[model samples]
Target: MENIAKVCSRLIFLSVICLFFAQAIIADKPDFKYSFGCLDKGDYTSNSTYKANLNHLLSTLTSNTEIDYGFYNSSYGRDPDKVYAIGLCRGDVKPDECRSCLYNTTNFLIQHCPNQKEAMRQDEYCILRYSFCNIFGIMDDDPVYTQHNVNDQSGNLDTYNQDLRTLLDGLRNQAAAGGSLRKLAEAKSTGINNKTQYTLVQCTPDLSQTDCSDCLLSAFGQIPLCCDGKIGAVIFTPSCNFRYEEHTFFGPVADVAPPSTNTSVADIAPPSINTSAAKGNDGNKSQTVIIVGSIIAFVVVVVLIIISCIYLRVRKPREKSESKLINWFIVKKV
Candidate 1:
């Protein structure tokens, strides 16, 4: 019995130590939120000029100090070897963080997709993509990616969905009406349980108002299919994305003054999407921490429960044997 108790105590102590280390690990290295899509379009030879142009273009794409608006579009080389790229940072991201996010994305694409002529990557804060053809000013919605919270809301889901839709619709309009510099909007609304539904919608600034609206609409339509009843969800497409959460998940947005009324939308220099960059926010990190912590905590609890059950089972038999011995002694004495 003593041995069993000691063993159980050791196990419980070890489990606690493991739980502490697990949480430390998670805090030290938060899981980065990102997705990669390596298109089957085509591949370039290692020594080909296309590869050289791609290397040169991506290497220097974020080095330009002049572009602080978080939208970058440029082409390198000419003809068949020309590589077009676009990088877009979240509107709320600072210029330096935006550049850093994009720089990391460029490295990611090159490392992960390697020889693919067309590839795209979306980080929590930014997106980076490249192609052989002119992807400029064109809205591509395919190859969509969606992520939702694992936990569901407790209140009436019908009311929650309706509130979410209303919030997204308003944000979509606000983002679409933005000028060529930026097309992004964020707002919050009260939902069931009085939980605040925070939402953000964004489109590449190069897109026309109509194009931006259409792209966001397509993304919104995907919510019912992908995230019904979930407390949080995000849908990503090539042209646009929308995210909603029960808690605040975005940073303070900078005030962007409206463009001059005389400036024609067509006259604005069209920003293109080829290779772009955005930085991650604290919301993604917190979400990752919560999810990881919950899983680790649950595992630890289960292990402790099992250990406790074994200890109780082992102690019960010893107690029964001692009781029998005491009764036998009393009878013999009598």
Candidate 2:
């Protein structure tokens, strides 16, 4: 149980960090393109047919876009049609990270669950799940985790809850109304505690608006489990997910306007620092300084070694001559 807890903490830790860091980039920065995926793993018996079919289905799920996904046929020889699976990457993750994550999750799920037909793996940038039953189009929020920071409530929890409700409702509307390829909603509001809380609510494009709202609503309730009085938390389910925190978690949206990095004022740096790209010889000079400093230090060490050897050679002979003079003086005194 302790090991499992540790594993859960470590595995789920990245999802939390990603949510926090997403806000690190200035909104003015260009947004990058990405893809997403989802799956429902239903329970199944040990011996079952469709084993070959399951393998084929998984193989047919060719990886694509910024999101790469695959289903590994688990049964080595036995045909178990009883197995079902799905893999979804974040809409903003790079294709390379998505691919590596998919590959890792596939291998991990097999090792962690063994022959079990029902299992799920939620990661920092993607999700992987498999079961025997068909779960598409259905909304599931139960058995999910909603977590937040641990701090004293500034005012009443109810007031903050109401604020969250109003803001999330607007975000929900906006996200559900997203395009066919992506569905995401994020907004911020000032709570009674004089703190700014940002909430991000989203779902896989495959799910209906009803499913998305229902999932977000249900996840809202689970926030007490992992994040009761904290600043933020993430409640993720098989199909939909939501997160709320005081800090920004998602990076600025990538510029969709064709190979452009700078286009608008909002693409400028954040309030804290200047984020412009380094230019010309100044940056190059700094790099050269580092290299030149290292080489000079090496040469100085070699020169010091030669000087020390020369001093030692000269000093050793002088010391020997003094010793012989002392012996002659001792003999004359006798």
Measured over all alpha carbons after superposition, the RMSD of each candidate to the real structure, in angstroms, is 8.1, 16.2
What number of clashing residue pairs does each candidate have, in the order they appear? 15, 26
Q: What lDDT score is found at residue 287 in candidate 2?
A: 47
TM-score of each: 0.72, 0.55
Model 2 score (lDDT): 0.54
Per-residue alpha-carbon lDDT of candidate 2 for residues 1-334, written as tens digits (9 for 90 to 100):
3554455455446545643454332221222222222334433334545544444444433343322211111222233454445565554454455556666776676565655556677775666665666544456664574444444456788877677778878887777766433467766668776887767777765468777777777776676666666656666787777777665445433212121233321112111212221121233245446655755665565566556556666776799899999999999999
| TM-score of candidate 2 relative to the true fold | 0.55
Give the residue spans of candidate 1 off by over 4 A: 1-32, 256-334
Candidate with maximal TM-score: 1
lDDT of 1 at 119: 96
Worst 10 residues of 1 by lDDT: 266-275
Q: Write the residue-wise lDDT of candidate 1 on 1-334 in tens digits.
A: 6676677777777777877777664544323368999899999999999999999989888877745668777788888899888888888786788889999899888999988999999987899899998877899888899988766878788877777777888899999999777899988777788777778899998799999999999999998898898878878898898887766667766654434455332212223333233443656566667967787777878677677869697778999999999999999999
**Where does model 2 exceed 4 Å of error?**
1-62, 65-83, 224-226, 254-334
